[model samples]
Target: MNLRLSGRIRVSVFGVAILIAAACGGDRKTFAPPPEIFSEVDADAGTCADRCSLDGRSVIRCSGEIEPCPIELACGGGSCRQPCDAVATEGSTNGCEFYFQPPLLTTHNDWPYSCYATYLVNTSTVPVDVGIEFEGKALDLSKAIYRTLPGEAKLAPHVGAVMPGDGVILFVSDRESPIDNPRYVACPKGVVPAVLRDYYPDGTQLGSSFHLKTSAPVSAAAVYPFGGAASAIPSATLLLPVASWSKENILVNAWEAWRTYSPGVQIVASEDDTDVTIYPKADVHDGVGVVGTPAGVPATYRLQKGQFLQLVQPQELTGSAIISTKPTSTFAAHTCANVPANVSTCDILGAQIPAFERWGSEYVGVGYRPRTGDEHEPMPYRILAARDGTRLDYDPEVPRGAPLTLNAGEVAAFGAGVGEPFVVRSQDAEHPIYLAAYMTGSNGDYWGSGRSWQTKGDPEFVNVVPAEQYLTNASFYADPTYAETSLVIIRAKTDGEFKDVSLECLGGPVTAFRPIGTRGAYEYARVDLSVGSEPGVTSDGKTCYYGAHHLRSDGLFAATIWGWGRWTSYAYASGMSLRSLVSTPLLPK
Candidate 1:
């Protein structure tokens, strides 16, 4: 319900689906209660005891007569406080149940008590049967998410446990060399986080993507540590599941000239699949003509549910396309690298790029939130031609000095140095190209490489989310150890385009705003994610600031988070970033 611009507006409730938007108001309020006043008479503490804390944001169940409250009190009966109606978050979903296990992973935790992977499994109605498969080994588990709390938030509690207690029986393989025989273990019923130290006893550095097949509906996420012993540069990605898979995709590749970490592609099959084809960038003539059928790719490839295939850079295969017979999830990466054309050691880079079909016709390039005048910084952006004969035109263009024509599979990159955020559009809808941006790394004072003692100054990558797919609301998780955290937001510039820009954490609404930039229709903001700040870990050890946001906009908008890693007095740290999981699924093609 948008708060009426003015006051006096008639409200009515017809059918359940019918909703009345607020309009202009006049002098008097229609339903507002009288001003609140203190009473000399004693009140009953027993009746209202624990209502606010025990029930949380649940609706207020009055114990007695309604007491008058002032307008200042959002929702209150006398002095007893109540939660006002929070904006309900209900993003579009296809009602499909399949989801992919995340494509990229970092170290699960530190050491000793730490594990190999940390995954959050959110189950749906009919409990899901899950199976985990690794190099020829398998483990089965089952679990369900019980409905609880506010219905709009889709809150569910984690139930069940990982069987076999410790890593003894299920992972019975001798913890020595890798047993390449892959298999998937089906579960009966249960849910809990598991450690793969039994499978990878060498301890987590950078590792493979585990294939998790679910029997019922579910949403999943997996995160890993990217930095070495001295620092923490952890990263994560949300699985889009099989129902959300795409058939075609092409984009900027993540390769390191210094070779700190290699660039590669990871693919997971969504069904009992058939033929899968891969196309390398260099194998195409002028990015279009075929030169011997995807040189480095396998001529015959296939995967079943819960099976994954990883293609490494024995060859430079960036800008390549993956075509599969069945729906499949894909992830791209540079393992880990550094920033600014400057910086010392390498940071991590990984993102789940949506298929070319999900690509938007228009986009604007912006840099990671800078400590000073961020608008003046110039960052490089890559544009991949989705089809033949695509042309890119920029509004109030800057000094690119590059060609604009592109053929199928072609890639073109240009710098947006201190220019207005670019406004680009393609000549035809069929000629749409995928968009992405990269941070050059740190400044000259700190940039170094190759050796373990230097800052990993590798490039960082994040998808320039399709402007048309942007939602007024977006959900994200910020790392506690990240040195800097910022948000990149883009919305329609015209009036009445957006409304009630608010933030939500844990399970309630919060008013946390830190403006980083206002680039025309876009608004950038910084978030405090320090271990001891708001949205930080609570006394219960669970993170309080990680959850979905409630956005009540009048029209459409786009937003994403940018996180960097650095130490207080250290000169050797570099930063990396990727877009957070988008809850809204793309329109079906």
Candidate 2:
């Protein structure tokens, strides 16, 4: 017998005449034989051909044949399927499980300071039950009280359940005491503070890592020195889930002045017996609690779950390479840092660094919007090289002093003015680089002598999410303590126009995005989230700053949340989709 197939089934017989008709059908379309018919034929065993259906939704499998499926489709489970079916979408900052290590913000026990993990519900209709776990025990939200600063006697309210489209801030830790004064806004109901053990002491080398798990996907942001006196240095960062953790990362941080304060790096282990090796970019001063290593030297340490190790140095640690045996969460921070080493005012700057694999080759950044005056100060940005011979090309040209070529473990710094958007790309994807944006202190006297201390915003450092890591939607929180809170949004022109994006608060549109950059493939917009002198809470007693925000577009976009007060400011990427850009064995050579 001979059979020929042409987009349909055909059978040829030798002598016997057989008539085959559709079982029950009005259309006369031919159909492929069922799998059972081929199973009985011993000669057809181990022979299969896979073809995608015309609609591309499924596949048709033929027995006793050796034809392969299309390149995009794979033969499996008796059908043709896309190989990506088994691969997950690129990881995002939002996830159901998260690990966080609160950076050392201040060493003063008398100063009022608190660490907060602000949870933003991503579900549209479903309420998520978020659990804060420390020391392997789930926290009791009912027993938790509002975090208060030092010298406060009255008991504040507890945090409430995080409803859909709403957000709740959990007091994760404090400096000296357990629960101190709660700042920003009034405590919501059904919310509780994490246990005291969650607190990572100031200037101490100890393990105080915590985990956050939720019934549904959610986005989290961490603010150190969340609520403190005016003198307190504040910093914030968008927290990445445990799924995005990797075995290697590079430290991107600001400079450390003489004896004032130190730039630090903290590593938190997700699994027990994780060995972390650090390659310092600058000389690490000893006697700062943790043993220090010299420039170009490597030191290794072993840590367990719920534990963290911190390295503080009087010199800059940017471009430092951290390689670990297991996945770990890493953060770049400054105990207290001045934008220019000579500047008087200082503030804490901290942000979680994505793994080296997630670093991208291209980035676009805009300086923070001016806090008060019309004159915009130049924002400082640093680019760290992931591989040797990495050359940078910037749009509209970078500053005169900016280094265009950088080797492995090298960093270049430049300043960009507000409203001036810049794009930087490395030689290629193989030379991935990390970008960090900084906000100068409020003193603003670096260039001139007449600068005043009454300036609004202070020094801050925020990691710039690569253009490749942009997400379509991001759920974030704007801190209420700052007098000015705004979002610096960058959307691809290839996506829909700016009108397609929406910033919602309390289930309604809240922002009128004003275009900032006019000439670029990417558009930049600044949305002022300020709601009068009082932040977070609206006049009608509704929450305004803590809620879900969505940018409706198929293309990717990036957002950075910034808030500033008198000599204090915080900035962080709203959310990022982490994509591995390099192969494994990410250890520096």
Best by TM-score: 2
**Deviation of model 2 at 106, angstroms:** 5.5
Q: What TM-score goes with each of the models?
A: 0.57, 0.75
Hey, what RMSD does candidate 1 come out at? 17.6
The residue-by-residue lDDT of candidate 1 on 236-295, one tens digit each, is 444344444665545345543344344555566656644455655443221111113234
lDDT of candidate 2? 0.61
lDDT of 2 by residue, 402-465 (tens): 6666777776666776666777776667778888888877776434444654767777888898
Worst 10 residues of 2 by lDDT: 32-41
Clashes of 2: 11
Find the number of clashing residue pairs for candidate 1.
Answer: 39
lDDT per prediction? 0.39, 0.61
Give me the runs in candidate 2 sitting further than 4 Å from their true place. 1-89, 109-115, 123-125, 143-161, 175-192, 202-204, 228-231, 283-292, 445-450, 495-499, 506-519, 531-548
